[model samples]
Target: MDTPKIELTKDGSNTLVHPKYNAHYHSTAGAIIESDFVYIKSGLDFFIESTQTNSVSVLEIGFGSGLNAINTYRYAMEHEVFVEYIGVEKYPISLEVVQQLNFLNFFSIEDKEKVFIEMHQSIENKNLNFSEFFNFKKSFQDFSTINSLNQYDVIYFDAFAPNDQPELWTENLFSKMYASLKPNGVLVTYCAQGHARRAMQAAGFSVKRIPGPPSKRHITRAVKI
Candidate 1:
């Protein structure tokens, strides 16, 4: 795979633009802000508050830059929550590209840069226990190949846009996601298209359109009920 080009987001964090697809790994306006709003607040925080659970198992669809994974880890540490993060990515970014990202600048923790490096360097498909509170694993596989059943509490569906990858937004894939989630499990995505919402609904999820991050009007949150 061609190495993605690093570009500075509006929030001063780096986002990768795919060489072939010409799509960005995150919103150009702000990478960190987008992840925080769409995945952390809308998905992780909501799950924690609603279930009152100290442990959360999250499956992320497109672990492009590892931004979502690192942010999730940070959230777990700050809240004293136990997090099991499974990130799936077909095209893992080159470490050289990862080294260029400025994600650590937004964080304030001892050796946070090392933690970020560890996230990228960790072995794929094998669980890496970063701490008693955090377990992480990266799957170098496509999301459609995931056949897990009732295994996750939340999913960060941060795949490329539907217009860019329409097959990923289909009802068939949404059905798989619905099956992967435990009852009441939530799936959050930045895509708020009507067809995507209908796809989730057709897959048996209770879909809701929530306020989006900066520069976007709305996002989708679907629950397995």
Candidate 2:
């Protein structure tokens, strides 16, 4: 895979631009804001409130820039919630490129910066406990092949847009995601396309369209009921 070019989002956070796919790792409007809204606020926060659980297990479909992971880590620490985060990335960016990203600048805390660096440095498929509240792991494999069953409370479906990665938004792939989640597990994505929602519905999810981040009209939240 070619090295992704580091670009700054509007809010001064970094996002990667894929050379081959011609897509961005995150929204250009604001990387951190988009991740916070779609994954952290809509997915993890909603799951926590709905389940009232002290611990959360999250499965992220695309762990491109590590923005969502870092944000989730901060949320867990701030709220004293235990989180087991499993992120899947088929092609991880180089550490040098990851270092070029301006994501850590958003945090003034030394420990949070260290934790963010540790998250990128950790080996794939190896669980690294950043703290008592946060357990982090990465998988350098395709999300479609992940077969874990009934293990996650939330799914961050942060793949590229459906037009860019149509196969990932298919019913077959969502069926796998549905099977990976526990009962009533929620899957949130930045996309609110009709076909995508219908595909989730086809895979036994109760889909809902919700407000999206800046520049985006709506996002999708699907639950396995």
Candidate 3:
């Protein structure tokens, strides 16, 4: 696959457009808005609210530009929540390209720029918690190889659209996700297609449609019970 090109989103954050998928790495309406809304507020905050826990374990698919992870870490710091974040990605973007993106401008804190850089520079498969609230690591492999069982408190199913990457949205993949999450764990995504919901249901998840971010109608949230 060719390297993705950077584009400015509506909310002023930068995102990448995949060559093969022909889709933006995040919502074109607003990269940060979409991630913060769908993955952080809806996914992580909902989990925290339901469990009333100061610590959380999160597993994210399609770690793309690391926006969602950064947003999660930011949320953890602000809320005094400790997070163990595992980001899974198959094709890791280059550090050069990562540096070019304007994700740094999204943070008002002076240290957050360093945080973003260090996150990309950090060695893959090595858990690092240099910060007070966040422990993070990346798995640089195909999602199919992952077989974690009851390990995650929340799953950020942030892969490309169902049509763009149809293979990843299948029942088999959702079953793996169901197994990877603990009981009562929730999976949130920007997809709400009927077939995807059915596939998730077939995999034992109770699926529901929820309000999406700007420019999106509805997203999906599924739970393992």
Candidate 4:
């Protein structure tokens, strides 16, 4: 594995890195929080709450630093919600890089670092269900090739911007994702591009734009209708 060159962005708080995928991952608004702003504070948190499913499955497009997965697991533990987290990443970051992430600084307690460490250890090739709240499967593969009947209740399309990875944002890709979603399953993403919305619509999803976090103007949500 190549060593990652970590750089502090101009804000002096966000830790930006050129990951193995030639993409960047950083906290929003100079906050050490990772998935909080993108995955939690956004409508995803509310979507999960509204669904009120006793056991739910989630599919993540880009695992990146595993921030979203970790945050979701922590939230499930706190709420006693049974969650199955499946994250897909073509280029996964090394465990060392994930450990260096400062996600807990954005939270109330620094002791959460230990929890993150345990989360990393918990991730394995096969689904490892534990704590009665978290079950995870981390895969290194392209999402387009994945074929499965509609199963997941929620989908987190956290891939890089369409400008960078146009293929991943295409109508064809969205069609595949649509096939992977159960009826009424919702998909959330940080992209609000017109073409992206059209592609999702072309895949039979009902799409809508929503307010994003600070620095980001808009986000998107789609439902498998």
Compare the candidates by lDDT and give the number of the best one. 1
Where does model 1 exceed 4 Å of error? none
Residue-level lDDT tens digits of model 1 in 107-178: 775667877888788777887888778999988888888899999999999999998899999999999999
104-159, model 2: which lDDT tens digit per residue?
A: 77755448767877778778788898888999999988878988899999999999
Candidate 3 clashing pairs? none
**TM-score for each candidate, following the candidate numbering:** 0.98, 0.97, 0.97, 0.85
> Sort by lDDT, best first: what order?
1, 2, 3, 4
Candidate 4 per-residue lDDT, tens place, 85-189, comes to 888877666678766766655555333676566556544467766567888887777778878679888888888778778999999999988999988888888
Q: Higher TM-score: candidate 3 or 4?
A: 3
User: What is candidate 3's local distance difference test score?
Assistant: 0.89
lDDT of 4: 0.73
Give RMSD to native, each candidate.
0.9, 1.1, 1.1, 2.8
Q: What does the lDDT read for residue 216 in candidate 1?
A: 97
Q: Point out the worst 10-residue segment of candidate 1 by lDDT.
A: 107-116
Off by over 4 Å in 4: 8-15, 19-22, 27-34, 41-43, 107-124
lDDT of 4 at 68: 78
lDDT (10s digit) by residue, model 3, range 1-225: 588999999999998999887898998899999998899888999999998999899999999999998888888888889999999988888888898988767766447777777778777799888478889998887887789999999999999888888999999999999999999999999999999999999999999999888889899999999
Candidate 1: how many backbone clashes?
Answer: 0
Cα lDDT, all candidates: 0.92, 0.90, 0.89, 0.73
Please give the ranking of all candidate structures by TM-score, highest first, separated by commas. 1, 2, 3, 4
